[model samples]
Target: MKVILVNPPIYDFSAYDVWIKPLGLLYLSNILKTHNIEVVFLDCLDRSYFETLVVKPDGTGKLPSTIVDKPNILKDIPLKYKRYGINKEIIKNFFLENNDADYLIISCSMTYWYLGIREILDIAKETLKQTKILLGGIYPTLVPKHAYLTFTNKVDYIFVSSNFSELFAYIGLDAKNLNFTNFPAPDYSHYKNLYYIVTRFSYGCHYNCSYCACRKIFPKYTAKTVEQFVNEVYTLYNQTKCKNFVFYDDELLNFTTTKQLFYEFLKLNLPIKFFTPNGLNPRFINKEIAKLMYELNFTDPRLSLEFTSDFTHDITDKKITFKEFEIAVENLINAGYKPHQISVYLLAGLPYETLNDVFHSLELLSKYYVRIRLCELSPVPKTQLYYQLGLDDTVDPLLHNNSIFIFNGVPGKVKPWCSYEELQLLKKFVKDYNESLKQKTIHSYAHY
Candidate 1:
């Protein structure tokens, strides 16, 4: 059997390549190869697809994009809608060339980016008329009914289950026979030029925050042994000689195994840098762990501090407290990390949250030396906040987009918490506050 796995382009107001790779699709590729099924992978968002783009030293860069017309739903938004990836003609030509595949599988990430999947489905249906096409990933998994209705005739099937048992059954295979204990690392060999690799030490989160979808996607928390995690990292590093590694774990420091993993990493003594794009739980960071992370060359560490107000504790499940956050910052700074090098993520535009609440959080964060990242909330389907707002499955997924959600909340369902102007002012406040700290650091250095 032959299968073509595709990572579709993202259609959004803005997009960047921050060590983003199709890790799930690559893992599926390895599984297919184990069954002797031939796999052909195409990543539309691959940086190597466009040779003219520049990449930074840490493997983070911009993607090649072309401005496209916005959908009628988003027409009022001032930002230019863009298709960030290889051109449509390139995708069409590739499908035409490889039309003989028996099955075509496409992966989707953000629910708001389904337009890219629709485009890929249209092209696939036109070129590979005889092949069966399947769509699966975060989008479809979260809103299966909407996905099925949206692409009713375009896709042959939609895989909603995380275990891939339904997919195996449809393809005439028994998933129960496969052993997951020896699951292979994602097949990064498909990429022409690899820069950084993304891996996870754990599978899911133990806490179920109302705004998060991690619990919905991964119902149970599971982790790989420290030995297994370290061995996989060593193997990938030896193979690609890639020095940058990013952890996609929702809770990188929540478990005891994480400490062992860090010690193992330190023992390697390899000149590699680590990053955590997903913010870490501040409650887990201690003096010892902070020291270990600093020794291991972890860069740009970000802590998850969703809110400062006590009333917001119910929504965040009280995962972190102000005292814990302060202690974590002090530990990191004492471990030799400058305050400006640390970052704290503060969420904005949440339902029932006033602009004063956000501003208060920002003002509190300004007291610290760390930088602040104000994240606008995107109402994900099936999350507790989504249901609390009375948003049903019938609502268009486009309404969940963070870019326009702040300015224009669901027309009749929810009112805008803050206007675009207010959001801009809040951003400026953070920028100026961070800049003040930077100048202070410079002056202190000169004085010393």
Candidate 2:
């Protein structure tokens, strides 16, 4: 049986090289390949792949994109809109040229990128009428109702999890008790020109942070064994000869399983550098863990201190506070982590957040002498915040963009209080703080 997995184009006004990858889809592809099924991938957002194909000017393929149209909602801003992959025609041609697949699986990321998913599904339907098109990933998981009501008529099936065994059964493949036993690592060989390797040592978060959707999406925090994780790391390093690694785990520092796993990794002392693009829970960082991380050769540490809201943070996730956060930072510093080596993530523009609150958070973090990475709050479906606010369908998904704090729109004794100008000023303050940190020093410590 043949399986074609496609990562649809992104329609956002701005994008970044944030070590993002459709890991779920890639994992599924690897599993299918292990069972002797034909697996193919078409990543639309990869610039290297796009350049190699040489996509044309008219959103068609053969060269890299030059004229990117600004997204509809974000057109008011001064940024170029882009369809970040190969040309639509090239994608179409690739589909038609080798279109003998029995099943076509498409994976989506951000919920706001649904338009791109619809476009890809439409093209798939046109190219191969006989094949069954399945949709999965974050979009389908968070908004199943929207997926069923809207795309049910369009796609044959929608799966939220990486459980593709049921689909395999329909195609006469025996997929019972498919244990992680001998589970294959992700297949990145097809996209050889890729720069970084994005992998997950664990799945989901134990803490239910109000602003995070990790719990809703991956309710159970499951992790691979240390041996399994290290084996994959070895294979990836050996095969790709790439030293850079990015962990996409939601809770890589849960102290229970992940910490122990990292301890084992530090023993290896491989000449490889590791990074965590997703922020780590501050509570898990103790002197021992910090020393282990340093010994393991972690080049940069990404610490997450969303806000100094104290125990009220428990309202969202019963995790994090100024006390524990400071202890973690101190331990990191004691273990030889320079202030600049640590990147702290601060959440700005919360639903009812005040400018004073954000300013204070920045000031507090800057006092630690660490570089602050400001992230806007992007509301995901099924989160407490999303349901509590009673978000409507009319709400532009772009408004959920973290860059602009749309929730803080009302000003005072009003129903939906916050001014756009006020929110902009807050965002500017965070940006200015980040820029200033590059030039200023708040603390000093030895580097790993």
Off by over 4 Å in 2: 50-81, 169-172, 179-182, 392-399, 404-420, 441-448
Instruction: Give the worst 10-residue stretch by lDDT in candidate 1.
Output: 439-448
TM-score of each: 0.95, 0.87
Model 2 residue 63 CA deviation (Å) reads 14
What would the per-residue lDDT of candidate 1 be over residues 1-448, giving only the tens digit for each residue? 9999999999998899988887778888988998999998889998887777888988999999899998998888778999999888889998898898999999898888899899899889789978899888889989999998998778889998665677888898768854334567878888888878988777689888888899888787777788887899999899999899999888899878899999999998888999998899889899999999899999989899888765686556679888898999999999999988998998898875788778777777776878888788999988898888788898788888988788888888878778888887777777777787867631221111
**Per-residue C-alpha lDDT of model 2 across residues 133-209, encoded as one tens digit per residue:** 88888887777777777789888888765455656666667778564444578788778465667888877777787
Poorest stretch of ten by lDDT in candidate 2: 408-417
What is the Cα-based TM-score of model 2?
A: 0.87
Q: Residue 181 lDDT in model 2?
A: 42
**Model 2 RMSD vs true structure:** 5.6
Model 2 CA lDDT for position 372: 80
Error of 2 at 223 (Å): 1.3
Q: Which sections of candidate 1 miss by over 4 Å? A: 177-181, 441-448
